[model samples]
Target: MQFTSTPRGARLARRLVSHRLDEWGHPYDSAPNETLTLIAAELAANAIRHGHVCGRDFHVRLIECTSKATTVLRIEVADTRTERFPSLETPTPPTVDDESGRGLFLVSQLADRWCVAPRVGAPGKSVWAELELNHG
Candidate 1:
């Protein structure tokens, strides 16, 4: 999915992710749906706020994978800015008085695995998160 680089777009991306997950057998209220939706919201917001390029929009991709051992859902958000990639090292803790800057921290906490990489065939980068689903 591609969206305009705006707050509304970020919001819509989040909602659509939840809806898509629900359609994929993860109900709206399921842990996987809610968790992946939140991850999408944060990444989309970051792309809009930090990765915004004048006329370019952001792109999001969701993939579900199942194996004998576990099921995983991967969410990727790509933007047209390559110079401002997030730190691959441990995210620095924001000061107590800071009003923001916790998006990636939250992602690191919620996602079983997460990374930022060069956007394939594009002049930008992508941040992706994956969570292992519990079958119970």
Candidate 2:
């Protein structure tokens, strides 16, 4: 899904993710569902805040995969600004009074694994995170 690089768009992306998770058999109140939605919101918000360009939009993709041993939920958010590369190697902790620098911190804490990479054949990058699920 693609959305305008605006706050409203970011909010919509978050809501849609919750709905999609419910449709995929994870209820809205479930841990995986709630955590993934928060992650998606943060990613989308970052794309808008740091990568938005005039007349350009952001993109989001969600996928659920089940292999022989595990099920995983993958979330990806892409933006058109290629110069601003995000690093997941060392996320800084936000100050107690800081209201804004905590998105990636939350993602780092909530997601099992996450990274930012250049988008293929595109003028931008994608931030992706994956959450592992136990089927038992």
Q: Which candidate is the best by TM-score?
A: 2
Angstrom error of the Cα, residue 89, model 2: value is 1.9
User: What range of 10 consecutive residues in model 2 has the weakest lDDT sum?
Assistant: 85-94
lDDT of 2 by residue, 71-135 (tens): 99999999999899888576899999997889898999999999999998899999999999977
The weakest ten consecutive residues by lDDT in model 1 span 89-98
Error of 1 at 114 (Å): 0.3
Per-candidate alpha-carbon RMSD to the true structure: 1.1, 0.9
Q: How big is the positional error of residue 22 in model 1, measured in Å on the Cα after superposition?
A: 0.4
Off by over 4 Å in 1: 134-136
Residue by residue across 6-116, what tens digits does model 1's lDDT show?
A: 999999999989999999899999889989999999999999999999999999999999987789999999999989999998777788998999999989989999999
TM-score of each: 0.95, 0.96
Model 1 steric clash pairs = none
